[model samples]
Target: MSTRQEEATWTTLETFDVEVSSPSNRLYRNGRQQVEVTVKLRARNEDGRIVPLSEEQKRSVRLIDYNSGEVLPDIPASGTVATGWGTTSVRNEYEFFPGARDGMPGQIGPAEGYTFVVRYVQTVDAAPKRIGAQVRRDAQTVFKTNADNVQKSIEAVPERLPSFDERATSVEHGWESQRVVGDENDWDLRTVDYYFCGLSINGNRVKLREFTVRPASMFQWESTNPASEIFSFTGFGTPGSSMAQYNVPAAFSDRRHNPISMPSDGRGIVVLIRSNGIAQSSAGNVHKGACDVDARDEFGTDHPLRVSFKSSSNRNELVLTRR
Candidate 1:
């Protein structure tokens, strides 16, 4: 007969916040964001101590743009070693902020203006193998007894009898990504980022780039997921009129208002659920935001298309381009 053992179950306790601040702020951005989490043990040894073993375990975290599903590289696991920290607050701080370090590998600054959802996963060992034994066409499959002087005979079509057993073995670990959302909460840092984009301002436009860990379907809409579009026009007025262009939906909800920031050259607009918020935060330093007063503009409101603008403005037109 063959026997099998039960698999180990690793439980995730909790995660840290996705901190967002500028380089000017005390906050600093490293090449890779660090995340500290708490994990609990499932079983212990004979002496009641936690069993520990080292193996090639895969630990990964993903940071997804809540509006556009774009992944950021704030906490990519490629260059850093995945190590486990003992129960302590010092080891529980994960960094999602973008910054520069002397020997770092990633860019610095916020991934544009949009926020994202995070997911973390780890792969642990599983149950043991199952074994079985079978006896087919046996005179006595269940309990064999010395046959009487005469050999016993039966016409019944003998069935294959089977038995099972289990054996315990070594354990290993791995990880996966899972979305974390609640009825009320702006921050959900469950996943880690793979890369980050630096901030750049060209003329009157600003662009930011980042890496995402999930697809578009996950974090592009819904209330609490606010969307913003910021643009600026330089000095001097347009002879007749000017316009703004984007790679997003054309129409904005009535609740949305375009609020120009200081210098009056910049215009900030907020879009509601009417538009998918996915790509809104991925605008990199090179993002192109030029106002084309002559070209016919098409906002992606009609369908799933890029956003373009041609709004009439008295101030000098500006372009915000990102790659």
Candidate 2:
């Protein structure tokens, strides 16, 4: 038997507010107003009116503040299906406020006003979709992690790591997040990381090399920056590759679960690494990376500090050996 093929149809959905948020009338910028809006997506039908969306259209959506143009965290796609082309309404609730100033205090917003937009992204092969919305701001200012899953007890890292010229005897690991004002004028590319291992002594993983990029802004306007800085800093360990990689320490990997000797004075060496920003922080409280390894001897006593920064870079190398 022969099967018949049918033409496939595609449609674009229109986004609108459900009118289920603060401000009985519209958005205003007197102060920061908490807006709770549920954006709905639907396609056009034969009647030229809005109708339910097709199940084939898988969508991943996020929100952007109208006034400040601050992008919010992505709300993962929901209501995905393989069939039922058009039978259900697909939408998500977004909780955000308008009138946020970049460097202003949390109590105030910007003195400017502009239109807000709701953005949509579909999984199917197509460009991202967006809709314009009104944001009522009176030119005032607006503004503003799950741990415990980690098996490691995170500690503070020293501002400095052991120099490559020192003997290989101790080991440690740590990282930090830098803070900065974020906007179109902010830094985009974060530094690529590099780690190199040259000389070795008695199975010692102390000899270290490193590569680093410029730090990211600690105060992230949205959850992330649109810039390509940190997004471009991605790579994995290539086992025997002689180039820069992330998380793959040349000799540092051997230090895990291993302990070094404690000095008679009880002070040991500290190694540290810094992590880029996650683009989420308050003025005084941004993301920070720090760790101090408690290198224990046979006695299990936590005294000396050993630090190491697990950094990833594709274009830089940190030499742990003497010049």
Candidate 3:
């Protein structure tokens, strides 16, 4: 007779614990700046002992947007897992750009406020397991432009008719003006230039489209050569024409060439008003006029700007107010 001993076999169940670090509270609207988010994961058995994961299992870490409920394909994690008693952990670092319009690394746009989370999914023993940790509750972003305090200037040039030089002794034989012009009394051409600066949307440079300018009762428009009469430094087509149609180059939007008095380098829109026979502080001449602008952003959103101009004997002032 042989004595047989029965041995008991059991399996230890493995579980995963996830921990995440908070991200930046504020993100730039331009998407040039990024916030780093970290996620730490650990695997443990039923007996509280650390369990190491394979390379394939570690690649399952992902970053998710809680608001959109989608995995952020642009924000990929980078790090390694350490296996030890107290140091047993899988660390992942992700670069989060809140305003990234495109999923690419440097592409940016106006990103709204969103919540972020770290997620891990895997299948073990014919069962699926999903784990996630919150990285940030709420991250705020901003995108806007300031139209207040717009600077303006008025230039007056005298209009003269060409006349034959009767006094010419065959020395200067040609048509010449009667006299050198001066003061507003001799002014026939008036030019009003309105400088619009700070044209960025959420810290990102945007192209202006569908730009239309309308002048009130005081200002008069000429039917002839409307393109030359009403035009912008941004290169707009005929009045009310869309800038998108011409595909205006980005160089036109660069504010570096604008007047130094401008508030910022974000300047883009420059509207010039040209008129004839408009006198300053004259009895019949209108002193008050309103200029209305309708501009569309890259997102096809419309932003209106209202401006009023008043002229006096001493000076001329233009006030820009948001609508």
**Overall local distance difference test of candidate 3:** 0.29
In order of appearance, the predictions have TM-scores of 0.17, 0.17, 0.28
Candidate maximizing TM-score:
3
In model 2, where do residues sit more than 4 Å from their true spots? 1-15, 18-34, 45-51, 55-59, 67-71, 74-323
lDDT of 1 by residue, 24-89 (tens): 111111212222222211223355433221121112223322223233323223432233111111
The sequence of per-residue lDDT tens digits that candidate 3 reaches over residues 1-323 is: 11111101111212212322223212222112223333443333356544443333344444433223244333223221111001112322222222322222221222421112233221111111122222221123111111221121111111111111221123210111111123333323343333442234444454444445453222322322333232222111222222211122333233112232222222233333334332232213322345566655332334576645433221133345556
Model with the higher TM-score, candidate 1 or 3: 3
Point out where model 3 deviates above 4 Å.
1-23, 26-36, 41-59, 63-194, 199-264, 275-323
**Predictions: Cα RMSD each:** 26.1, 26.5, 25.2
User: Which of the two candidates, 2 or 3, achieves a greater TM-score against the reference?
Assistant: 3
lDDT order of candidates, top first: 3, 2, 1
- Which candidate achieves the best lDDT against the true structure? 3
Per model, how many backbone clashes are there? Answer: 74, 46, 1
lDDT of each: 0.21, 0.24, 0.29
Considering TM-score, where higher is better, how would the candidates rank from best to worst? 3, 2, 1
Lowest-sum lDDT 10-residue window in model 2: 154-163
Model 3, residue 287: C-alpha shift (Å): 22
lDDT over C-alpha atoms for residue 316 of model 2 = 19
